[model samples]
Target: MKFSCVAAVALASAACGSGDGAHADPDLGVESSDTGALLAHADPEASGSCQLPDGPRTVHQMKGPLEDLQGDCVPTWTQEELNAGFTRIRDERMITLPENPGFERRIPWLAADNGCEERAQAASYYLTNWDYTTPYYARVLVKPNKRLILKTDNEPGGSVRWTHHVAPVVRVDGRLMILDPAVEPEKPLPIEEWLPRFSVAGEVDVALCRDHAIGDGCFAAAPVAPSPPQIGDKAAGLHLRLTAEWGVQEILGRDPHRVLGDCPPWVECEAEPTPDENRPPTIRHFRTDRLESEVFFPIYVIGDNFVEGVTTVRVTGNGVDEIALIDSSTMRSILLASWYDPGEYQVTAANGAHVSQPVVMKISEF
Candidate 1:
């Protein structure tokens, strides 16, 4: 089922690439090329949309050993239990919700039959039903396969729309913290109130944010910038450099200890070169006219060191036919580039026309 307005707004903000032995083979397994097909067949009625497919509703459920249990499954709670349970966890221990003045105060409810106890229960139902969990500090970990839906009222200037997005949460003080890419890309939601509204299906672990350091659990697993390149001996008449950057943390918390090997004594820290930096000697040109009329920019990354991905080129004004990726070193255009080292890159059409951003090839080197 789809998320309510609150959850939709919450998730929209939290929000990656590579190259060839160039082995241009794509990791089609992780790639959601078929997601479009699955979405096409998805039940819209489940999300309160008229265009939904007719089928058994796919309720979001947690996987793993703790899937069936609820809230640690304690039979009895003493004073200590009451103190330690989510009820006593200070607001400071979780991520805060965003305040959007533009957001409509009243939202349509799909499952009014299951009226939530409060906003927190509403939020919980959205998350838990979708197999998403918001632990203590509004820190949420979304499974890659999950899709969030948001259906708008069909009125003038209102059309039912859906988007796939993600957001990460952090906790500070007695409030919830959020790092949402859609609302505040760089800035974080340092403080906000979390109202529990939904009944969770399984054992949802809500920890006190005070238990962990700020920005420790959530974004820490995200990809980090690689170190600066080290000058190595030149070879084959081409400059050979060795650079080290950090990749995505293994997310051991998501997997079982037996499956993922023993948890590291301390979080593992390793570095390697990024994909774009490892481009082959030959240069090629790749261009797309998808965002022909809009002002768009190409985002590329070298390592975590840079702020915005390298803005190779910017298309200004309107009606621009194509954008190309060229080699700065050789002044040659790269028609088809491969990406092996996974990172985030995009060509955004600010004007919003044809928003088709296809995955380029991925290449790896020995």
Candidate 2:
């Protein structure tokens, strides 16, 4: 019921804990002293202490609360210990596409473009399970029209932008150090250095949520939630509570390798590096579903090198042939399945003069 919301301007340091014994009262609407704003509507479903059982977790359950509120429950660990823990988690980054044959263990780094929330939640579970320390999350919520641009080698153009970002935080040598491997792969970054990376000319609101649910609570507690006009969408909020097991399994409920889609809001399912437009479109995967109405159902084709209006999709075979260009992204495209007869068909994507190799799709009679 207790969390800290710090309104930060130009990355100035702000205290991150409640000392006044303030707790959110559903009826009266508790106002966070830090933000001086009434607490956002609490999720009626959120209840009980935000703590979990000690040791490794597997089942999904409400986490129990931490008992160390005297110091805001942030761990006081040595620099060496902090760095070691950071490295241990950082090493979990996947070196290749998660689908690659040899891909191994923790953290989907390749899905880094817009999966910050999932990544952070997964990290928190690991930190707790490894016996490193139970950690709090540092959430940076940006204002309208601003972006948290992070330079990275993971995506094309050597950078990625975010509406907001959340990472696990630990107190090292009295300083709040961030454990975001996606941003600073080598070491922990102080909050000062970490905050400014989002925007140098703009101000952002920061909050320290005790758990995943509280992170969403922080966003709800904010004054104005920004929607980037340029992106034509709102950033997804974080809702990761690591009281169960290893972060990935807890969030995914299965092996990371077996899961498909469930992508973070920043990117769509089967998103990959933008392919060279000069080349033929590549079809990485395709997904289809049945709808009740079945009028103009969509066929989602995930791939690379797709031109918005110019690229075309062709599905042929089994007494039906269809081709159309509906909507497209560099990594994803939507083609109208239009209640095609149930049968196997060969599908190919084309951009300009180049065409992709044929892939198979089985459409069902709706």
Candidate 3:
């Protein structure tokens, strides 16, 4: 169950300290120490290649109440903010490096223990380095202990520390993406998937970008030219701490009410993402919760006489034109549930003797 491509080794250590001697103390927090092991996926041995553990394949060990059952008021953006963010990125005003073609998750200076500290540190670094070119950036509030997929501690109503987090979100590739240079460092994940990891009660994103040319002012979150954290200082004492109240949001000096308490009426609340469509290949109609197979979710390519027609096959529109031709068909298609982000593609099948319609296979992001 190595979700996504289990390729590169994850860095298990980070450097976290403020120039003001905030991390000089050994008792800073639980998530600051390497041996404390906040994220089990982070390698305990600093010298070891940072690979995920081979147990039950889940993203993170920590879990909180799902959004529906939650009883907290999370602060989120108004429609105006979303619109501005979209506009800023589309204008190509955010920072970028040729190395970053997007889809990355490596924070070079963060360890497993430096959750909130990494947020603080990375925000400080980006604010300093990209000050000139940054059209818009924000000290975004995030839901603590948010996992990309659901696999958990398996305890009900236990002492789950539902903490709030502070991270940087920058407009990238004409969309706002989370630049969480700590936990999932450098991974410019889509805002839609990243936002769900923030406080469910609510989130008030603090604007951090300033157009220096126009002399626009920006909120002062960290030093104007702070140095980035390195290995030793970054992973020392930045462990996560449990709290009954808003944690990182308060630590980052944001208004706690923006994350918890009364909900301000707004129309920007987005609907949940639609799951991948499970269209029965045999017919035009597709249905959800269908009892297709015993394997739970089976990716089907239903069609009449799929074995007869076989030709120049390859998966198209997948960034790369992967020429994987399906020579012989045992059944209709191979199970595709295990493939990550296997959506938005066409299977170019060739007709042998008879002319038939090309079987187009679309895998949605369920």
Question: In the order shown, what is each candidate's alpha-carbon RMSD?
Answer: 22.3, 15.0, 20.5
User: Candidate 1's C-alpha lDDT?
Assistant: 0.22
Which run of 10 residues does model 1 get worst, by summed lDDT? Answer: 237-246
Q: How should the candidates be ordered by lDDT, best one leading?
A: 2, 3, 1
lDDT at position 201, candidate 3: 33
Per-residue alpha-carbon lDDT of model 1 for 1-366, expressed as tens digits?
A: 211112211111111000001211111011123233222221122223223213211112111222221222111222332233322221111221123223221111111111111222232323323333332223222233432222222111122111111223322332244433222222344423221111121222222221111112211111111111111222200011000000001111111121112222223434333323223222111222111111113222121211112323322222332443433211122121322232223332211232223333222122
For each candidate in turn, the TM-score is 0.18, 0.44, 0.26
**Alpha-carbon shift of residue 39 in model 2 (angstroms):** 25
Candidate 3's C-alpha runs over 4 A off are: 1-113, 123-137, 140-162, 181-187, 201-218, 221-223, 230-366
lDDT of 2 at 304: 60
Q: Which regions of candidate 1 deviate over 4 angstroms?
A: 1-126, 130-176, 179-189, 192-270, 273-280, 284-366
User: Compared with the true structure, what per-residue lDDT tens digits does model 3 show for residues 1-366?
Assistant: 000101110113222211112112211111222232222222122223323224331112212223321111111233454344333322222322233324222222222222343434434344334321222223332343432221111111111222233344433333445545333332445555654543333432222331100011222111122333332222131222112122322222222233222221111333422212222122111111222211223333333233323322345675746645332332233222334244555544333433234444554545
The Cα local distance difference test for each model comes to: 0.22, 0.48, 0.29
**Worst window of 10 by summed lDDT in candidate 3:** 1-10
Local accuracy of candidate 2 as per-residue lDDT tens digits, 130-181: 5554456676656556666776644433676766667777676657788887
